[model samples]
Target: MKKLTLILICIASLGLASCKKDTIVQSANNLTIIKYIEANQWQSSADGFTLSASLSDNRIDDRTFEDDGILVYISRNDGNFYEQLPFVYDVQSYSYTVSKGRIDIDIQSSDFQSAIPDKPTTRTRVKIVLIESSQ
Candidate 1:
C-alpha cells in the first residue's frame, strides 16, 4: 500500500539519520519508566479508554522521538507480572501510543464482539520503556 510504503521509507530515513554523529544512535540504551493508573484515572476514548502519563523525566526527547522505539507493558494482578502491550488477555486488549513527552495506554475488547469497557474499576500497573539510539 502507498501508506505502508511511505511509512517504511520514513522509518528508514530516521534510522539512517540517527547513525550519524551527535545523534541518538550513539546513546542506544534503554530507559524504563513506571506509573500506576488508579481505577479512576482511565479516561474514555473512541477506541476504548486511555490513561496518559507524563514523560517528566525527559527520557524521550524531540530530536529522536520518532527514531526511538517504545514498549509498554501492563499488569493486572497476575497479568503475568507484566505482559507487553498489543497483547490480549481475558478477551481484553491492551496497547499504547507515545508522543514527545507523553504516553497513553489503551484497553478495549479484543474481538470487536463487545464495546470498549468503561474505565476499569481496579488499579493497573504499567511499565513504559524507551529504546533510544541520540542527538
Candidate 2:
C-alpha cells in the first residue's frame, strides 16, 4: 500500500509538471485599398507621360511604407473596345512613387507606343490600384 501511494504521487507530480499554460498575442490582419484610379488617360509626350492620383485614405502615410506594405498595379486597356493590352516589348518601363497622400506614375510614351502600336494615341485607358496592409 505504501509503494502504491508513492507511485501514484510520482505520477501526479509528473502530470502536473507536464501541463503548462502560456499566453500568446496575435496581431490583427487588416488590408485596405489606399487608392483606386480608373479610366485615367494615357497621353503622349516628348519625355513620356506622367499621371498623378491622390489616395482616398491617408492613413497609410502614418505607417512605414517599406515595413508595413504597399502594392501598386497599373494596367492599360483599349478605350474604344475596353480590352486589356498585352505588353509586347521590353523597352517600356514604369516607375512610381508615393508621397504625402498622392501617388505619381511615370511612363515612357515612345516606349509605350512601340509596345502597343494598335492604340497608342488617346485611345488607351490606364488604371491604377494601390493596396496597403498593416502587419
Candidate 3:
C-alpha cells in the first residue's frame, strides 16, 4: 500500500514538471522575398522595398536577426541576406540581398534582445527590406 502511494506521488510530480509552459518566444527564419512589379518595371529601389511581412512569435522562418546589430547569413548561392538595426518592437530597417528571383527575410527570436531601456520582457515585431545590388 505504501509503495503504491509513493508511486502515485512520483507520477504527480512528473506530470506537474512536464506541465510547465515554455515562455521563450520564437520567430521566423526562412523568408521568400518577392519582387514588386509595377508598370512593367521591377521596383528594387532602396526606398521601394519593404519588409512588411508578418512574423510569428518574432521568428521569420529559419533565420535569426539581431537587434541594433548586423546579422549576415547565406540563404543560397548568391542569395544571401543581411539585417541591421533591428528592434524588439516598433518599425526598424533590416536589409538583405537578392539576385535571382526574390530576397528572403529570415528572423529568429535568439537574434533580438532588450537593451538600453532594459531588456524587453515580451516578444517584439521587426521590419525588413530587400535590396538588389547592381554589382
- Candidate whose lDDT is highest: 1
TM-score of model 1 (CA atoms): 0.63
The global C-alpha lDDT for each of the candidates, from Candidate 1 onward, is 0.69, 0.47, 0.34
- Candidate 1 per-residue lDDT over residues 28-47, each given as its tens digit: 67778887777766667654
Number of backbone collisions per candidate: 7, 0, 16
Report the Cα RMSD per candidate: 14.8, 8.1, 16.9
RMSD of 3: 16.9
Which stretches in model 2 have alpha-carbon errors above 4 Å? 1-28, 32-57, 64-67, 78-90, 109-135
Total clashing pairs in model 1:
7
**TM-score against native, each model:** 0.63, 0.40, 0.19
Off by over 4 Å in 1: 1-28, 46-57, 78-80
Which candidate leads in TM-score? 1
Worst 10 residues of 1 by lDDT: 48-57
List, residue by residue over 38-126, the lDDT tens digit for candidate 2. Answer: 44433444433443333344644655444554545544433233221223325555555666555554454345555332223332334
Lowest summed lDDT across 10 adjacent residues in model 3 is found at 34-43
Q: Per TM-score, what order, best first?
A: 1, 2, 3
Model 3, 87-122: lDDT tens digits are 232322343442232334422233334211222223
